[model samples]
Target: MRLSDGPVALRPLRMRDAQPWHDLRRENHTWLKPWEATRPVDETPEMSFANMVRRLRAEARAGRTMPFAITWSGTFIGQLTVSGITWGSLCGGHIGYWIDKGHAGRGVMPTAVALATDHALQTMGLHRVEICIRPENANSRRVVEKLGFREEGLRPAYLHIDGEWRDHLVYVITSEEIPGGLLNRWRATHGPLHA
Candidate 1:
């Protein structure tokens, strides 16, 4: 499935995206490394791009994740995934995303996130969506703040990022809080001003 508004879009990541995806990651190594998750030192070797895509596709098919390519003007710019979905009483998921440095600060990430969160809440019938960002990631925090997600609290050593465990700020929004949908709320609050 694809979700879009104007120039920003979120579509399933395809095998064909491997090259562009690798190029973006390679180019943005310094820009993204600080915020990227790191595998445990003793974990198995990383999978190839093709295998990674296959795993992501399998997760999507199993209803455990939605892996999307963040696109702008018909070009792949990054990735956004709503993962760790829980059905029972929890009925919620967490969002994780990254954008190429060239696309930063243009409202692309926020728009992509809004679209994904809306899909999770409206179509998937999820109860809430959460985003955890390192305290140092001001750009990412701004995205959630712009969307009006409430700050829950700090999660000490939440996830291993870069080379060590990092403290993360938890932010969340519930389905009921965005009855009109996240995209609609975003547009109303941050859209172009009318004369």
Candidate 2:
């Protein structure tokens, strides 16, 4: 399911993506480390490509989770994942994503998110989606805000990262609020968002 706005496409994550994923992550380690889960030195060895492939494939085989590698033309740029999916009365999940430092501000995550959210709602019949971002991560908060997810409130000690508990701002969106969906709302409103 590629969502195109020119030439870029947000597609599914592939097993072979391990190499590019590793390369990009390693290159952005300094930029990504603060917000990402801190791993043991051994856990983040520069040569754990096999582990990435195996884990990603196994996770994809399970029905409740979906992850994608953001791409442009033919380059793997980053990752986006929607996990903890629930059914029945609560069709919801949590979203986590990161953009390659080179791709951070070029609409990659936003488009990836729009396409992924469509899958959550239309394909999986989900009702809502949530994202909790560190209070200091203004850029991440902007991404959720651009998608129109309301601020749900503060969650003190919400995420475990950098080997410590941290606070986060909860943001959420429901199917009904999207007006058929994000692309539709954008088409109706004309252009993307800011702030």
| Candidate 2 structure quality by residue, lDDT tens digits, 1-195 | 555544355667766787788789889998888898653443645436566556655776776677677777668888788888888799898889888887787666776677788778877789999988999988888787777789999999877777678888989888888758875554355464332
Write down the RMSD of all candidates, one decimal each. Answer: 2.3, 3.5
Error of 1 at 173 (Å): 0.3
TM, every model: 0.96, 0.85
Off by over 4 Å in 2: 1-5, 39-47, 187-195
Candidate 1 error regions (>4 Å): 192-195
Best by TM-score: 1
**Candidate 1 local lDDT, 87-190, one digit each (tens):** 99999999999999998988888888899999999999999999999999999999999999999999999899988989999999999999999999888878
Per-model CA lDDT versus the true structure: 0.92, 0.76
Candidate 2 collision pairs: none
Worst 10 residues of 2 by lDDT: 186-195
